[model samples]
Target: MLSTEDLALLEAIRETGSLSRAVAHLGKAPSTVSYAARQLEERFDALLFDRRRYRLQLTPAGELLVNEAARLMQDVARLTQRVRQVANGWESRLWIVTDELLEFETLIPVIDEFDALQSGVPLRITQEVLIGVWEALREGRADLVIGATNEPPAIANLRWMQLGEMQWVFAVSPRHPLAKAKGPITRAMVAQHRAIVVADSSRVTEGSTYGVAGGQTVLAVPSMRAKILAQCNALGVGWLPRHRVGLATRLVEGTDRFI
Candidate 1:
């Protein structure tokens, strides 16, 4: 409940150690400082100043008030700053959802840059596959979405821009039959093998799948990383992000036969 003026008056008196000196430090009349000092003692019903000593000093109770007041002042300052930040349209927290096709590691540098702003907004990152990315935003579960694949569905107040294009490669384990298949493998040939796919995480939507041939068996995994591992272990074969295929999985040549 202590006011800023009260704290300033106490600090000036404690620092200067005398009535006249305190008045000079506070840029106030000597009479005014003397009256404020007496008022403070009466308000607290305690002798806050030790005038018995030649060099005026604060009593133990006064010292405690000043120390605690400093901490309260800091809390007030932080609260005021947060209020202004909110008034200026800064979000209290941000939730970002990205498709599993985009590696989470790729966002580390961007996160570091956002941290430099010191906006005091907490960030949460999550991943979904295929339509689940857009579903997160539409369902009020995400503040922003990244690497969402396919055209965005209709959602009120939605804003979007194309981030970039992603290239895909039909990949399989070196040990798989497709690894040595003849040029221009047919959809019928792929249908003979199981396809590894990342399961969509949408709760309300029917969800979607990609790169699976008709009547092909499927190994639906939770993430793209799992699909890649499945292909590497010769568990199945399917299209993967071109950048993620790497040397562990062999890219099927002549994929132009059936995109």
Candidate 2:
């Protein structure tokens, strides 16, 4: 049986189009890679390559093997990624807590991207309040945490990767009485309507660092789903990500109460 290293060299040589280049890439002297190839030629008892004046050309059998080896190389790459992820506690082992309200716009896309790129690295995510998400990560209850942040990041043990600017928008259910206007919503108008807002759990500070306006007081709801559910009742307005905006709520542009 050919050693795995032998198979790897075959694939690498095919990829780089030169035995010397493959040896250099693998940090092996040219002679070592050449010896491996010679061993394979002897085992098969057939000329796999036709040496030319200036370049090496694969014979028919050699070309066929290279094509088959390409498939094996892909499998090996994915396996290697899984092994690395497992070694680092990243494979089948990501725990995330985030606002359920941000599902459509931000959450789903982020989850999809990681899963696709990492392949076998499965992610286990939880939907929780902004504050609860922070607590989950901080208390070692979760692996990754995300929510609104106006100041510097605060998770001490876990590292945070910023995903660009997360923008907040105002959404009122389509069934609301004032759903038909182009003018900006005043804070006073929002107070007159029922309002839904996400509250942090034990880890979050009670007041807004982003600040709220329009005389609209926020009713702190626990998780993202709960906030959306409450807002879905058509009795109130709430904050939502633009990526997740839906038919139930129309975004109130300016002068809308948001935090």
Compared with the true structure, all predictions reach lDDT values of: 0.82, 0.66
> How would you encode candidate 2's per-residue C-alpha lDDT over 1-259 as one tens digit per residue?
6567877887887878777778887899888888889888998898877777446678899988778777777777778888887787654567766655445355777767775774676667676554555666667777766653533346665565665676667877666765765698776666676667666554556533122456666677665556666666665676766654553343333233333
Task: Let me know the TM-score candidate 2 reaches against the reference structure.
Answer: 0.45
lDDT (Cα) of model 2: 0.66
Q: Compared with the true structure, what per-residue lDDT tens digits does model 1 show for residues 157-256?
A: 8899999999998887877998888898888999999999999888877688889978899989987767877787889999987777663433333232
Best by TM-score: 1
After superposing candidate 2 on the true structure, give the runs of residues whose Cα lies further than 4 Å from its correct spot. Answer: 1-93, 104-123, 146-148, 151-153, 174-184, 203-217, 249-259
Single out the weakest 10-residue window by summed lDDT for candidate 2.
250-259
- Cα shift from native, residue 176, model 1 (Å): 1.4
* Model 1 lDDT at residue 31: 84
As a whole number from 0 to 100, the lDDT of residue 180 in candidate 2 is: 68
